[model samples]
Target: MDGQICCMVMRVNLDCNSCCRKMRRNILNMKEIEKHLIEKQQNRVSVCGRFKPADVAIKLRKKMNRRVEILEIEELPVHYEAEQEAPIVNHYKYY
Candidate 1:
């Protein structure tokens, strides 16, 4: 398994009530032990009741036939970037 996990976001057309119900039930039944493990190391005691964006992506793919968009992706600690400090402006220099 690759260390990098893809985080996908999708907007789908779910037109039927039955499909919605099944999707909800399916989501509830699905479990990700690896995500729980990651959270456990980060001082997160309970994996339940937490937002699972990746799981949502899976559900969307299962229910809809549209293409999913990949948005706001970030790798682990190595790729993190801090905000740059604002530049100091001198009004006298422009005049």
Candidate 2:
């Protein structure tokens, strides 16, 4: 990957169960997202992947048609592991 692996947290208006479900579906459909967590109580969503934070925010805004506020963005450390005859693998720890 060219860009750094990172985790982005955003505050969104998740009002009901349907809203949460919609958000989950959207996040799951995004190919660039490796993992995601939706905190309905906090009205926040955390997404981890190799992507530009701004780009993700824009995408969410357009897809959700709701206000999206970026709360935090942090770069994650990449760990490499390899087995005896296997290719190297990249791993990321999501916080």
lDDT of each: 0.39, 0.86
Highest lDDT, which number? 2
**Best-performing candidate as measured by TM-score:** 2
- Which residue pairs in model 1 clash with each other? none
Write down the lDDT that model 2 would get. 0.86
Per-residue lDDT over 8-94 for candidate 2, one digit per residue giving the tens place of the 0 to 100 score: 999999999999999998888888898899999999999988888888889889999999999999886555212323776679787
Residue 53, model 1, lDDT:
57
TM-score of 1: 0.31
- RMSD, candidate 1, Å: 14.0
- Model 1 poorest ten-residue lDDT run: 37-46
How well is each residue in 1-95 modelled by candidate 1, as lDDT tens digits?
Answer: 13333332233444566545554455456553223211212221112222355665555565544343434333333132122235677768653
* Model 1 spans with C-alpha error above 4 angstroms: 1-9, 33-95
How accurate locally is residue 40 in candidate 2, as Cα lDDT from 0 to 100? Answer: 97
